[model samples]
Target: MTDLTELGVAAIRDGVAAGSFTAVEVATAFNANVAAAQAALNAFIVATPDKALDAAAKTDKARAANKPLGKLGGVPIGMKDLFATAGTQTTAASHILEGFIPPYESTVSQKLWDAGAGMLGKLNLDQFAMGSSNETSYFGNVVSPWRRNDGGNASLAPGGSSGGSSSAVSARLCPAATGTDTGGSIRQPAAFTGISGIKPTYGRCSRWGIVAFASSLDQAGPMARDVRDCAIMLEAMAGFDAKDSTSLDMAVPAWEAGLSPDMRGKKVGIPREYRMDGMDADVAKSWDDGIAWLKDAGAEVVDINLPHTRYALPAYYIIAPAEASSNLARYDGVRYGLRDLPEGAGLQDMYAATRAAGFGAEVKRRILIGTYVLSAGFYDAYYTQAQKVRALIARDFEQAFQQCDVILAPTAPSAAFALGDKTADPLSMYLNDVFAVPASLAGLPAMSVPAGLNREGLPLGLQIIGRPFDEQGVLNAGLAIESRAGFTAKPERWW
Candidate 1:
């Protein structure tokens, strides 16, 4: 019998449909895995085993009675702490929101429950989803299960602010998990952990109850072991929500149906501008191999230039933090979350003390920078200019898409780095999002798929970017690459 903990959502659904497995049994297996993995990785802020089992029991009873099942049936999944879950602590891995439980669940989480997907728990993340590395999280950093290939040290980073989601999913704690992307949280961590994750077009998934970082750029997405599983999860996750003003009113495509191997007559663009100095040679080789595979599949590979790529990282830093500062202002003492008392302090003093005591260093630094950029004297010079640059970056993608159906590039400059390697230098941390920020700025749909491993045997990933609301193109392209890559699940040392 196949191990329930290792089966993908689609496979589990198939098993349940065929009477080969029961939903309760599947849930129990995954719950056990979560308990074992959480002790080592600290992946979750909360684990709702009782809730999951109850939901799974209902699914099993429905199956026995021949009642219709939802798409996800009884698959176990993890929610990033950013999404609000009714009656559960939605801390976003920050001390400020430590005790605040939402009276309502986010639309995405509700949708998953409605579809009969079982929730394992809320996963840890960078506080308010602000930082590129998981180390900035108030809960502590997540360590990758994959060790150093050089045999130097066993400890390594799992990437962030969705690091816990990726780490847990990659570690087999759950078959798949939901994640949010403001800058590159979903794709970066997927790349680092050797898994597949997709960030649909901006506003593809509603942001109603997700703890906001940058309202304009924030998106919720799916992370799984492979592309097809991500497609299944994305299908359940994407839709319009009246609650989120920016939610796009569009039809969610049949993402899994059109995954064809025949790429004949399709055009793929290779952006020349993504090749930066100091890029790892292994990543470059993987890029070459990916292009070769595309050619083998009969797709025309053409080199294109996104000249404005150089300005994307800077533009993102200014805009994301500016929005973050505004969104996070609600966390002051009186409204919700933690309150600091400075021994008979005044209102202003209490507010100041609360923030100083509750927020992590990176969160505070971002708030300061965000406030500065939006200040009267610097508003036009920084935030406004970055907005203009963001438009230009989008235009670059528009022009590139005019020539090709999809764009391919390295997901990150390198694989996961050691913990604390770049935390001290914020700029170096920001640079990790170099390849992903452009798509986020353009509101384009993008996905990361594990392509191959480097000489060091660490995993490498290739990113596929599609035109706005063109998630079908992204998924189809990812399917093509996944088939050729032949990458399979491997047991991590920590697992």
Candidate 2:
């Protein structure tokens, strides 16, 4: 029998189908794992064990009766708190939304449930998804399961925004988890935790009911222990949702269908611009190894240039914050979520007091910057220019796609860093996402797969960027790299 903790979603489903394990048993094991890992990693804001077990029991009943089993079947997954779950506290890791419970579920969460996936509970995240390091969370920072290669007391950081999901998945608390990426939140955390994750093209997944940061940039995706599991969860999570105006009407593709090893004529691009200075030697080696693996897998590796890469980071920072300012304006004292009651305070004063007391420093910084950029005097200079630059960045990827099936680069500059290492310097923390932001700007599909381990014994991942709606290409390349890299064990101490 496959070890419940170690099995992927696909393996777990197969086991359930073959009567090797029941959904109730599988859910129980994962719930236990969540409790164990939560003490060390601080990954979850809530763990709904009773609800998960009940759902899993229903799945087991259906399977035993030879009734229809949904795509996800008995798989248990973690949800990022940003996605509203009915009756659950959806705080978004900020005090502003404390005790806020939605009456309805997010479209993505509903889809997962409809597909028979069990929810382990809401995971922690950077406050308002505003920071790159998990330290900004009001719930406390998430520690990476991986430690320094040399025996040390270094508390490693699992990357931010989706840090809890990444940490939980890496720690084997759940088979896979849901994450939202506005500007590299999902991919960066996946890279830091040494797991596999994918951010589908914008609109590929529904945004309805998910707390908004940047409406245009925010997208929900899956993070898992491996590429195939990521593929499995993504297939169930993506679909057309008429409720979300921006949701795409495109048919959800079979993400796992074309994952063949035959890459004989596939053209893979190595973007020359991503090779940044000061990149760690181990990361560089991992990139080279990934390219070698692709070439050995019969894919043609070619150098491609995305000339606008230099402008992407700046443009994304401007655009995402500008959108955030508008989206977060709903959090006044009169609205849903937390409200501050100050003695003798009028309407405006009450609103100010509530926001001041609720929002964290990083969230406030983003809102301030966002408001400043979108202000009348600065609008044309900052927000307008950033929009134009975003267009240019998209065009760069469009041109690159004509020459290659997918583009490859290092997922991050390095593996997980020590907690508190970059928290004091916000700019340094933002720089950590330099490599993963360009794709988000272009609204392209991208994924991170473990390529190799650094000298510190921490894992490094390679990113694969695909054309719009071309997730199959990205996953195929990732599967190929995954087979070659073959580094499948979690940190020994974590186990």
Candidate 3:
């Protein structure tokens, strides 16, 4: 093997379990890669080498004592900064919570640790997980490890909210990383970076200590280089938590053990609404390729229409921001990270000043949009209507699911675009999630698996969405595509 860092979650766990290599060896190799690549990739906001080493020590001792290893034994992964890890500064990449370290760990992170995973560090993300690109991070934007073959060598966006998680996994800095999807944050970034990520059904993973973006839409999952690794990591991350009111009280399934790519007797649906005019040629071709792949896997392909899909993006924009506005109100100058108290000001002035100074441009924009939509005069005209659209979108998926086991679509409108390509145009940036938001609105389990490379040598991905609590079906569809697509291209290590 070239390096321990090249191993994925399952490989690393089995390797450590069998005494082929020590957990410390794997952790050390990944820690070095993370340190060496930080300047160029900006993937991590903080690096916790000691945390990894400490976890490895415990694992090594457990093995020596013949103690049973957990599901993710010996793997070190990135914790997206949105999760509140005990004693680790958990910023949602926002200045408002710059140095705020929670006394308690997030339920998801705790679950990972319980399953023998170690935290390499907290990863960077769009500030408050708000933007489509990683540019909104207060720490700085994360650059993809990829560069186009067109010779300009202009940096590309790694995709947002979960950009740091995607970049780190793609670069082999970590085997897999935690990612939360509010509106395509996990799947879109996974598609952009040529990796696999799943956003489980809403409430599948507890939202207890995750920095809230959209209360009902945000769901945590895993990002890895391939489908099986994502399955393994997700199995470790998902479970019930009483602390979160929205947490599913049902038992977590054995998803990793249940994974299979065989699609015999499975019906795959191609959403007719997704084949819109002006779709990129590369994206359209990849969708076609995905259809053929599922067919080759012995699955039957059929046409399905999600009539409300055209309204998904608009509805998402309204609902997510509106929820974010309500969730973010607790970050006042009184209790937390950034307290911008002017010498002669009262509480309300401090609240205004702190928010103005602490929030990024995109965050403020969303907050204003949210506040405006939730206003007394416009609430029914905007937020209420958006919720109704969301319900329609969900019903559309429910009806479509009756005709098929899973739905296939393109992950994004295009492959990874240049860093500044849509920065000046917010609407253009929002369109990147057009193909991804419908599933989020339905609160379904969805995934993105790398399909192939575009003409520019950047990757394109195919999305598989399944019914609620049906992540196994989504992962299986993704596996069928992963095996056939043979997406072995990794970003060249420029850092």
In order of listing, the candidates' clash counts read 0, 0, 0
Tell me how candidate 1 scores on lDDT: 0.88
lDDT of 2 at 258: 64
Q: What is the lDDT of every predicted structure here?
A: 0.88, 0.90, 0.93
Listed in order, each prediction's TM-score against the native is 0.98, 0.98, 0.99
List all candidate RMSDs to the true structure.
1.1, 1.1, 0.8
Q: What is the lDDT, from 0 to 100, of the residue 173 in candidate 2? A: 89
Q: Which parts of model 1 are misplaced by more than 4 Å?
A: none
Model 1 lDDT-worst window of ten = 486-495
Query: Can you list the residue pairs that collide in candidate 2?
Result: none
**How accurate locally is residue 115 in candidate 2, as Cα lDDT from 0 to 100?**
92
**Cα-based RMSD of candidate 2:** 1.1
lDDT of 2 by residue, 1-495 (tens): 556988889999888878888999999999999898887889999999987898899899998799988888888889999999998889999988988989999999999999999989899999988877788888888888888879896888899889999999988889999999988899988988889999999999999999999999999999999988999899999999999998999999887876765567999999999988877899898999999999999999999999999899889889998999899899997868889979998999988999999999998888999999999899999999999999999999999999999999998887888998887888888888888999999999999998877888888889999999999999999999999999775877553
Best by lDDT: 3
lDDT of 3 by residue, 1-495 (tens): 558888889899999999999898999999999999999999999999999999998899899999999988899999999999999999999999998989999999999999999999999999999987899999998999989987778989999989999999999999999999999999999999999999999999999999999998999999999999988888878888889998888888888889888999999999999999989999999999999999999999999999999999999999998998888899897888999999999989999999999999999999899999999999999999999999999999999999999999999999988888899999999999999999999999999999999999999999999999999999999999999999999998878
